[model samples]
Target: MLEMKLTITAPDLSAAINNLAQTMSARVPGLQNGTSTCAEATNTTSVGADAVPAANPIQVTGVPTSAVPVAPAPTSVPVEQTAPVPTAAPAYTLEMIATAGTALIDAGKMKLLTDLIARYGISSITELDPSQYGAFATELRTLGAQI
Candidate 1:
């Protein structure tokens, strides 16, 4: 014999029971007239049936209790999915190069900065796109290293 507590939340309680009964009828071996009453059987897992209260006890028979699938309460499922990791921004950006250049210019390399802008054939730093920023920053660093 097996016993388990069931806290069912069906909108139509009788319909749920009927549906359960039909499903159980197919699975269990000794159901009389292809049906069972709430009292005729009890959940098979009841090691200590007397100690347990039966506010809404599910009656199961003719199957191992461990074979039964117990549905956990809705609250047990995690409502909030784990947030996806935020994507990191690209390391090279036009604004970052511009800012880095500004610091270099303040250190007395305004002419060198202007020379770099002319080498790229761009009238101003604004003419360079984000894609060009990495190469330009690399060239600028190489130029600084030479000096």
Candidate 2:
């Protein structure tokens, strides 16, 4: 025979009793039914027909208790996606050289042009169309001058 004292505190008395029943059932094997309630046979043994049992019966008492309120489940939010940035193309162009030359001439860059023609080739410039120049226009011009 085993004697035990159990005190259960829960938000409600019924919940506490339910918890206590489960706990008692687990601790005392074969003493409780599937529902955690003591079997009629065990209850009868505690209070037999002839006389009261010798050992003090297991007592389960419940007291009203409080617990911190649980917060609600968090809401899921969708994120906005941004498009990828485009890569910039190379800066060198035939038009850039022609434009630079024209600007230099306007700003008294004749000496610069003469040096360029000497260093590169002037004949290359003759092959290029005045309306359209590419990245190698200056080199072509220098080459043309040399030829």
Candidate 3:
């Protein structure tokens, strides 16, 4: 990054500043040495009566004082989502299966429930299909028989 060192308090510095102003005025036409070019930038040329006047007339270069319009929220979602329904055993659902498994887990046998789940080569209780829930529950209940 480029750096600039300017000491305004130094008595001899005023002459250097004057020389810079004179050079800018000579090279850049219409940009007067003393007048503020920052204030002159705010023009109501394109904007109408509703345009808000800036609180600060002078702004950082290349930045507009006007409010830019907000982008509207997305109108469409990427994926089409529908509720999962079991074709067979219409009365039972995935929620019921999850509840049953959670009951076993909550009864101080979380390891037993997870081990039974692993035996079926499934990672999560939610992965058990609605039709398979009855058999899965029966096998899980057999853990009590080991006692």
| Candidate whose lDDT is highest | 1
**Candidate maximizing TM-score:** 1
In order, candidate lDDTs are 0.65, 0.48, 0.56
lDDT of 1 by residue, 1-147 (tens): 565445435445545666776777677666543443344223333334654454456554343455467997677656887998869633676767777788778778888888899998998889987677767888777656221
Task: Estimate, for each residue in 58-111, the C-alpha lDDT of model 2 and write its tens digit.
Answer: 344332122223788999897888887768533445556656666656767577
**TM-score, candidate number 3:** 0.32
Q: For each candidate, what TM-score against the reference?
A: 0.35, 0.26, 0.32
Cα lDDT tens digits for candidate 3, 1-147: 433332223344445545555565566655544531333323332234444444334332322223234888979867978988868643545676667667776778889888888887889977776668667766755755221
> Could you give the C-alpha RMSD of every candidate to the true structure, in order shown?
14.1, 18.7, 19.5
Query: What is the overall TM-score of model 2 with all chains considered together?
Result: 0.26
lDDT of 3 at 117: 83
Q: Give the C-alpha lDDT of model 1.
A: 0.65
